[model samples]
Target chain A: MVSVQELLKEYIDEGRIKLDPSVNHHTITVHDPCNYVRKSQMAFGDHMGDLNRWITMQCVDPSLYREMCDDPMNNFCCGAGGGAWAMPYDEERLAYGKIKADQIKATGAEIVMAPCHNCRDQIMKGLPKVHDMGNYKETLYLWELVANTLVIEPWSEEEIEKAHAARDAQFERDGIEMEEEEE
Target chain B: MAEEAKPMEIHIDRKNRKIGGIAPELADRCFTCGTCSGGCPATGLVPMEGAEGVTWDARKAIRAIVFGMEQEVVDSKWPWVCTLCGRCEYACPMGIKLMRSFRAARTLRERDKVPGPIHKGTMMNLERGNNLGIPKEDFLYLLADLGKELEEECCPGFYVPVDKEGANLIVTINSKEPFGEPDDMKFWWKIFYAAKEDWTVSSVNWEGVNWGLFSGDDPAWKEQVRRIIENARRLKVKTILYPE
Candidate 1:
């Protein structure tokens, strides 16, 4: 089960996806999701910490990227894992997330790239309300960062026709009917 | 002579000694080094209010379980407070898998007693195939609407294919996106279009977020996983892309 991160990395490496770092000229830091890093290290022996940083670095200017004090495997949880985000223990959840808030504050980055939904919600919604993160600007999903920065080359007429043909063939092979639509 | 202090008579509830059938020996190996608590962000968060000497930490919770006070651990808000992020396990000197015990503690709680919307969400996913109980028709409508918006916004020929057999990939969407941030769904579609990936979204049981994993319902977790797998197999897809 490859992550969008993995796929993005592969695409970027293969020259299929080109990222334009100037899309969002803001200081950014990556928040490592627990499952992706620490737990993954325990279970898979590969922390994927470096991979996350690699992706983040690719999306942002090198000068604008900031590293959190505790990176990856040692990174603090956003305190929303284990169903805490949906749980009734808001008070406790916020208290636990305080550690993450402080970590982000120390980084002094305008944006936090949280790959996990739970972490993104906590950092984006839960943290700033209680913590003093005046410098914090936005939280982005890693894929969102990539999507926003992608340098999409408009498809040529031939490419568009070929893609349409391919799509029609796929539908036909799958025995699915497609409504008439412009390519 | 001062009256002899009566030895603290403790009635051990053997029933609570083991959490969700997790081995007591797992807890028995604790070195009581307190490293887990030191690293644990939830150390003192849930005080089990009004209960004296009831504070939370991985070490203390393990001790409670080891001492047959597992019921107290489960009854309190401590288990819920712990995110089971595995920091305690990572820092454990004895190589104890603390998250297992914590997850087991979550299982010990009654479903209704399970905190917040997690259990309910899991049940909804089990019954209706998605959290938030969004019906299949509404989900499809949302997908089609959002796909059209995405096409107009960026991708020219992008339409989210639903249940397309023989597709290379079956992708699941987090229910939250369709419910609240529908635009977030475009991020993936934009990427898929650029890559020209052959991916199909299952109209039924297509939720990416599995609350069962969080709620400590093993069967529900497995069932949710099974549904995703079944969708992938039904579509004859080689990959099941679940970002959550």
Candidate 2:
């Protein structure tokens, strides 16, 4: 399987993508897929170092990033894998995912990037219903976050004004006072 | 209270009982080779304390069966915990189908006696045609609602067709996508749009999450498969795509 984190780093390195200013200001956490981080052994071997370097180069803080499980190579199955999702073990499956959900919540990051489909589904379902971790922080695919950050095209002044107006409108609707930030 | 209790007698059903097989013979043939256990994931799960344990290690469970100790295997928790990932079979020198045997033992148990919530989900799927039990009409409504929202907000001219006839492909989605995480449906929709594939999602039996297969309910499994196949035929779709 293609390593999504590596792909994102390569895009950033090539100047083909840039992080959204809003995202850079907010805390972001990534949930390492067991298959990618452990089974593939790429997370520790090389990808981890590369990803850390890239994040620093981008001026994004890494404190929000959480440590993965100990002995991740032999990590407990996420209960979604090996057909557990289809099996008659909802409570057990939910119980298995509790630690992962707690780990994400402890980071206090505004978003959790889940790469694998099974992990994503389990986290999305188990986190909210079982763990009662509400939808305050978004759960996104790694690619989606990278896509958001890439500076594909510079917005025209008019487009920028329109975007600001939308943001203001959202703030007004949420009853929050807005303070302009220095560029 | 002072009366002596009669001795309890155990009765064995011979006709329904399974006899021991070559597994024990093969165990006897082993020349103290550690090759099999070294590669087996379940090796540590089983108890191995002494000489008898080692001699019967390979066929210990098999010997239990041959000796009519069926409860030893049937009541064990090992079967449910095994993921059946096939790692053991691949590494075993004896090429033993330990996982297959475990699965067979699980299958022999009565439905109610089978441990796990998967069995209940399987029964639900059989009775309601989907494990999540969203009524057929409700499922259609949700699809329609999502299709409208997508077309209005994100993708113009995008439609999630339901039971459309003669479509090139029929796609089945997990019910959880519609019931719990509706936004996740957008990812697959985005992919389909990029590919520009002709496809239709069925109003009936559209869920691809087959709990029957996981719960070892063959009749329910067949019913679920039949429902999907029948729907595909009705829609005249040539191919069925099951998204992960």
Candidate 3:
């Protein structure tokens, strides 16, 4: 039930870790499973997109993010949560997920970010079969996104030099003067 | 004149205090707002033949239950088709528990009459410690194989240990990992590897999913949980991370 991203944020605030937000390059939209969030009544309220947005933005460019309609607790169940995927009623299950599939389709984002396993399974399986998100990538867990993007150790010498160069170039482009070095 | 609602034959089992999984006390709570039905993805989502006049949506189902039409609720395919995602229950201002009622209603049906995989999964869970009904030997083999491959790829010499005594954590795994989606398990293993987590998968009661919970079998659910706890104790692990 914990938002590990928020935990990572806490660690960052405490100066325990550094995160590189540019780790992800995919255009992403998020799916909030109903179990963890119950439409504004539970788990940080209906717009988990707020949290998801911040978290995803932390891993990738904010411009690459997309929001699905009826997000957070308002998000439709991808028809796979609640043990429905294991059930035998495939046709009905697919039908029940039409709204969810439609929502995913509407987003048109390359990757549908689903933080829960069941939701990811449902969306991954059903989106291609039931909806038309065939070429879209499989869903990704938020934790995986965070994990993949983490700056576990200090930057390499080459990385630091490149970063400084990029920073000075950006600042120069913005007509800002560099601070003098200590004597 | 407004059309009078026709009452049909049915009555509550007062001794049971509810039909299926419903609380008879909440039976009278619905205000017939159609809120549940409006939010539901399955209300009229299915075009079943006999659902013509039957009540299946949250509000209408509550109305029927309050009127003691418990049998009708039990009989509808709505219980199976509903997916039980539990949106209506949370959205209900009255705090109606629709999904559990549907699940309870599902359980009320003859065990043989329940939906296919759910019934099978529950039976398999009770009999084989997992819904996949994979024999212990085969399960172990897959774990060993995958662990060896992963160990070679990342951790070099260390394997994905199973039933390691006194490990810091005894972790359960979803059967789906070993059955349909083995690669997904790699994701978690990498994390554990990175963190140097002292965790071991159990050789028995390793299934994380409680199909018993899904199929409304209380005893089976309790038994499954108890088995995992037992495994943790036997291994003397400090923590038990239940599989999600």
Candidate 4:
């Protein structure tokens, strides 16, 4: 399996992909997938450098990044492995995912980037319940953040003006007064 | 006169007692080594309870099968509980290869006899496109509607290219998302739009989850894999990305 983190790094470092520096600087933490960390050995191996470089390339503060639990080869399962999610032991699986969710919450970062699909699913579903119960914060995928930051073609002045006109027209139709506010 | 009164003696075939044609040489190879049992997560499961039963570990189970003690091995609950994590193979000193032996024994058993709901799910997946037996039209409609909702609600201008031919990447999504949590499908669409990747979701055989792998059904597993490959081929996708 390809390491999404490494792929992200290659995209940025190799100049195949570019992200707006301002958007990329947002603080983030990565939830290492057990399959990627332990099974693929990407966390501990030379692949670690790729992730470090990728994070650095995004201009994220080094102190903001938190280490995963039992990270690298010894990382704990995100509770979705071995078809655990589909089995009769779903409660157990979610309970296990809570550990990872807790780890992400401890980072206090705005965004959590989970590369694995199972980890993403489990975290996205379980974290909100955790948050509702006052346990942990929410998690998002690494790709989501990277995608959000990509340096795509900016909207042209004409397009921006058109969008502004559309918004004003909608507000006018609703009889809502628009006021300019200072930042 | 006493001998004449003796009841007719019947001899049972002790050799036939072997379970699943277990061989004696395979049994002899096991050195009562605890390596297999030590790493096994299912060690203390029923019948193989605690340390006393540790001796009848995976290697022992294979040995009993090999020694024509099929009844003892088959009746043992150890095989059903084992997750086949390959941790035992990693920890074994003698390289006993117990999991393979157990799998062979499992294959020998009838489909109905195979343990767990996962096996049944595999059969369902083989017969239906998904383990849930979701009709193709329903699957497509669910995905299409979810994609539209994502574009309307969470992320506007997002497009989930369904059945787009000759895309750069073909992504296989797990059926769980579309079936259970349709909104979750939005996340991928958002990512794809933001990344500006040439990606398309297939209308047919797009589920990435392989139940056959979990059920130890190779043919079913291959069928699922083949479906994905065929879809990608038909679409002329350069890469088939597995989301899981």
Candidate 5:
């Protein structure tokens, strides 16, 4: 029942997680997953659902965030929902995703932040490469961006040594050897 | 302006009135509102072959299902075109499950005619304990190997804990990661590292996608669920992160 987006919201709200949007530095649009946003429990009695109010916005700079024309509950599907992503219909799913592709293109965003596995795959497969705009956008998981921009305590040599020791123990414990470092 | 309009025939096959005879609540609910069509992303995209150029519409498809035109529904390519996103179902004032109905309609087709990749993935899930059919040894190797690579790259202490008993989190991964882009696995590892969460991925039945559900293959879907459940039980993890 606990979604990562809601968790991210909680972390940011409590001031435990600080995000620097400039680290990502892209005009980004959120691709709400059907399962998490639309199929999940609804907002305070609003039947149509409020997807545009995605709490994930808390992790990004609102000014840089772009909204898809038909967003949230009313948003067009990426054509990968309902297990269709695994369904064997390639041309059909690709055709079905055209609507989503159009929406992404209209936003002019360089990145599409899709948290769901199916959504990420569908958009990646559906983004047409023939267009000048196609193949330029990067599909990223919500957490990837968060991790990419996370302000971490710089790795001191002491920490690095400890990490290397742990890695060595793991390699030894798991019966794995490090790949040889090439010259 | 009206020269006695001919009365339209209202046909309903009582014997075949229900959908798969499992539940028929929405069988007679569609009043041909066309709202579901408006919300569908695939509505006007793909058309059935040899038909007058018209887009796929859920209301019309549902009407066909309700009236016992099962063969026509199955024959149409529009069934395949449906993303099953449930947008139509969500938009339906009648609250009909449009996607389930489409899946039921899809089942009416011959097993051989079902979409190929999903059909294969479904078979693979039953045979190999996951959709991608990743071998157990290789899966374990990749987990250890990738953990080393990830740690060297960005995550300093990163190690993909495999089959670690009594871990707090039992996270299942998308098969796409191990079978294709291995680098993506590091994203979750980084998050886990930042949070300092104790997690492990099972060496057995590690794939998170159940394509059997996509093809309406019960035994295959059940098999997938059983393996994940057994792995988690065997590992004695506190919680599972199977997103699907």
Candidate 6:
């Protein structure tokens, strides 16, 4: 029942994934997904709002990270939560998103890390067009941000062979054909 | 033909009123201090019908529900606009669970009246295993292609394992990724390859999102949950990572 954010943080802490913050230069801010953070807090008595912050902060330069005026649990929705993004209430959704657009503008960050898909779409595609954003550049998934900054060390030939063998064995066990590669 | 409209009457004696299992009488705990409304971005945005320069807010919705105005509240666009973000509950001095009440309001709407694409998407997700109704062969083909591309990019031996029994993790995906943003799928696979974790993606009923929560269809959402659990059991996976 753990989120991928938890798993990513665990892997990083365990040294399975190494992050290089120097690879990224743009100022970034993390948008707290309401369902992922606030609602979960109300229901489960615990949330990963802080963990998401910790993960995002690890992926960028210390100076490049920015915080919105509102803290994680108290942050504004991207206006797309509760299926508004998929719904036809474009007027209301965009009107609600004006607050988020302002928050991003105030941060002056080039990138807004939206961990949830709905937040990402609204922040990236829906907000800036109407809000007249100046500093806003792009939106990225929390994991995508980490993946881009990953410092991948090349594996040895033996390690490569072992991984190949393991993958092949997995496919075989699942009764899947390795030869069915799509063109 | 010009009969005057009657003013909406409030039922003062209707005590112990509940909406979607959440008691609307809890509105009595509210101070009407406007903290919830002020903190909510949805406030003042729901334009008041037949009136100028006025709108509804969370506190207003609570009051409406208390007055046994469930049908009016259900028909209004107020609940859908709220987004159920929990900011009001988070900041309420009265410690009111505003989002829960709002979610309750959402459930009051008729299925046909549930706002755009959500009801249809829920039905599609139930019938075809995804919101977009992408067929199994197409989904599998797209995954295989993406897997090969990711393998060629950085992870040489990388492959998206489907329905691998006894894996430690079973992952669900948002239909949007495979439908439009297929490249985004690689971010997690890259992580999986790096960690060398034992995880498998289910070939069928792999959608991660349950829009029933949005449309207020509790039964539909529950059925969606059941499908995921059934998939996990079929694969014998101990963990379900629904990263929506």
Give interface RMSD (Å), model 1.
2.6
lDDT of 1 by residue, A60-145 (tens): 88999889855577788999888888887888889898888888888889999999888999999999889887579999998899
DockQ, all models: 0.55, 0.08, 0.15, 0.13, 0.41, 0.63
TM-score of each: 0.92, 0.56, 0.79, 0.65, 0.84, 0.92
Compared to the true structure, candidate 3 yields what TM-score?
0.79
Q: What is the lDDT of residue A108 in candidate 4?
A: 61
Model 1, first chain, TM-score of 0.87
Cα lDDT tens digits for candidate 4, A52-152:
33554474556555554443433344555555555565544555455556556666656566766666766677545643323234556566556566655
lDDT of 2 by residue, A57-165 (tens): 3534555454444443433334465455555556656765665666666666666666556666677666577684433366665544554444444335575455346
Give me the candidate number with maximum DockQ.
Answer: 6
Residue A105 deviation, candidate 3, in Å?
Answer: 2.7
Off by over 4 Å in 1: A158-183, B1-5, B11-16
- Give the 10-residue window scoring lowest on summed lDDT in candidate 5 chain B: B14-23
Ranking by TM-score: 1, 6, 5, 3, 4, 2
> Model 6, range B98-199, lDDT digits (tens) per residue?
788888878878888888889999999989988899998788767767887888889876778887889999999999999999999998888887777889
TM-score of chain A of 4: 0.64
lDDT of 1 at B227: 91
The alpha-carbon deviation from the true structure for residue B131 of candidate 3, after best TM-score superposition, in angstroms, is 1.3
**lDDT tens digits by residue: candidate 6, A55-90:** 988998779988884567788899988898988789
Where is model 2 chain B poorest over a 10-residue stretch in terms of lDDT? B19-28
Q: Which segments of candidate 5 are over 4 A away from where they belong?
A: A6-18, A41-58, A69-71, A83-90, A130-136, A154-183, B1-11, B15-22
Q: What would you estimate as the lDDT of candidate 5?
A: 0.70
lDDT-better candidate, 3 vs 5:
5
Worst 10 residues of 6 chain B by lDDT: B12-21
Each candidate's number of clashing pairs is: 0, 6, 1, 8, 0, 0
Compared with the true structure, what per-residue lDDT tens digits does model 3 show for residues A27-69? 8887776754563355354434556667677778888877886
Top-scoring candidate (lDDT): 6
